[model samples]
Target chain A: MEKTWNNKAWFMVLPVLVLVAFSAVIPLMTVVNYSVQDTFGNNEFFWAGTDWFLDVLESDRFWDALTRNLIFSAIILAIEIPLGIVIALNMPKKGIGVPICLVLMALPLLIPWNVVGTIWQVFGRVDIGLLGRTLATLGINYNYVQNPLDAWVTLIIMDVWHWTSLVVLLCYAGLVSIPDAYYQAAKIDGASRWSVFRYIQLPKMKRVLLIAFLLRFMDSFMIYTEPFVVTGGGPGNSTTFLSIDLVKMAIGQFDLGPAAALSIIYFLIILLLSWIFYTVMTTSDAQG
Target chain B: MDFSWMAWTLPTALFFLAIALMLVGMGVWEYVSPGGNPRVGVLRFETTRGDRLFVSLLGSAFIHLAWLGLVGANLWWALALSAIYAIGVFRYV
Candidate 1:
């Protein structure tokens, strides 16, 4: 398609640019300012160089949080992708079932973030919550607050409950769009079910799958509120992800300099990973 | 999150003023670039610029909601995810 290649196109993007400048650029500049400068009472400020950055880099707490973040993200992607595909495949493709399935899937997504966290937090309480009570009734010990393993388990379950619908919805969209002719041709060729899916459905779903993967990865890596609400990064900081740690530093303890430095590093990591995802997905899309 | 800044800071007021100017600027851009050929993308039909923008905005909303659901409330992750979504929209809608 021939585009006009007009310098006027810049004007079309102007609104987004302005919005980003306010929402992103300004906040980022503030963070950057805080990173290099130290403030005391009455807003007195002095240059601090990279001292804060160095401190954060050397801290074991930072390293531990980063590791926890990576592990959680890895676990989520591994489970959600395959599980979502399976659930999407099994969902009714037609009739009243389709809308029902869609509505059910979308319900979890409509809930607010903190509400989801609160729901799970109460839902997992060993003494009163359904999950906790059921486990106790069965003579099983499950205390997310006191047990590191249980805290990890509860957090993972809460995340899965909340996010698996996204993968299902995206996959369902891909699945529903697969033309009937593809399946008819597969049937005519007497292709095995696995072969049919492998050659047709899976290939057709690649774009959405790429989207699901990258979206999940970025979200999981930066996860905070749910775990913060659920475990409070508890059981001795075992579940403390980077975002939580950053908040604790910046807001909890009011360590602006180190927190700002950490925030920059955190932003850079997500940017790097997202860039890699975009490049790989787009190049593969082009080749395909 | 706080709108109090708008009342206190010149920079915040400038942001809103910039947004108003941008809306008018975009109308001019459309007028100058009379006809734009719709591009074929991941969607079944070809999409014009507005179509692409709409899809991305909707897609990015879900991405953010899902992030808050499964992950947390860190805006940086949302920004990164939005970046990927914008690339996808531009590349394939």
Candidate 2:
């Protein structure tokens, strides 16, 4: 049967489109304006053409920050996806345990971004914080402010704690939606636990997993608040991801042109990556 | 790193106002629907998932506020709160 596509749904989406344009589009255009023009203190702009973009692209600092962003995102995806699935699998399928797991998973997500950073900041302080104090007593020289390795580890740990639950929630939703009949059939066919997960649950969870991956990737890539609060893009710029660098340029140095160009480039990269992910997931859905 | 004074003001004022408003709103709602259970009313306020989610959210927010007051925004506090809230939901709801 041919389904009639409802045009009325567009109205429902119109509000969101307007909100997004206000929040995303105008700021983007402003950035585009800044990227191509040099401005003095009096709000005057002169044509700089692609000078800022070229400067940004050719800089070693930009490359380093980009590399850090890519590596951080890669690490987060690798760790969170499997860990989240395992957590979802172990959660109680029914009865008392269901809400327990869910609320625990949700708590980190609910805390404000700045608060998470502050919490980690204090928690990692060697003098007053628990983790740092314990590590110090054990004779580990573990100051994140001084050591690049410590800074990286602390940042990674903070992100994992903050975001792993999102993945878990998505995977759990996918898991719970599966029909009991599928499991029953697997049992009847004498399918092993691994086989059940591999052939049925994993495939069933593809869409949600894709969503989890995309959300996590985008969020990790754009992460600024927590790390900024914790490290301030210091320890000799070791933990300075692209977002942090952009903020430093725009706010710290007030270099409007290059910062604007960098932001546009950053937005484009995220958009491209997201499109690729959508295409891959949808095409796989068609095949499956 | 020195603790900025701004964090002190923003979170406290915002948290208190939010909680006060919620409680006042609930009080008014209960006064209008005198026969309805307040706890259940609080729980089932939202239609999509019912009052359970509402109650859970309230409880979690309270816990978070209390943590901020006591521990002053430490990472462990966030981690602990997350664990507490997640457990509370599974067990209570």
TM-scores, all models, native as reference: 0.75, 0.73
Q: Which stretches of candidate 1 lie over 4 Å from their true place?
A: A1-5, B1-93
What is candidate 2's lDDT per residue for B1-93, written digit by digit as tens? 542311223333464566568667766765677533423222222122224345455456446434544555444666577567745653454
Computed on alpha carbons, the lDDT of every model, listed in order, comes to 0.81, 0.79
**Native contact fraction per model:** 0.00, 0.00
In candidate 1, the residue pairs with backbone N, CA or C atoms under 3 Å apart (3 or more residues apart, or in different chains) clash, namely none
Please provide, for model 2 over A1-288, each residue's C-alpha lDDT reduced to its tens digit, 9 standing for 90 to 100.
999878587699999989997898556556766776777656566777656766776689888999999999999999999999999988889998898889999999999999999999999999999999999999999999999999999999999999999999999999999999999999999999999999998998899999999999999999999999999997999999999999899988999889987886787677667756765676677677
Q: Which model scores highest in lDDT?
A: 1
What TM-score does the A-chain of candidate 1 achieve? 0.96
As for model 1, its CA RMSD to the true structure in angstroms is 10.4
> Model 2 segments beyond 4 Å from truth?
A1-13, B1-93
Give lDDT tens digits, candidate 1, residues A166-194: 99999999999999999999999999989
Residue A220, candidate 1: C-alpha displacement in angstroms: 1.0
> What TM-score would candidate 2 get against the native?
0.73
Mind giving the per-residue lDDT tens digits that candidate 1 earns over B18-91?
A: 54675575567667885544766665455666556545655664565446445654546876988788778878
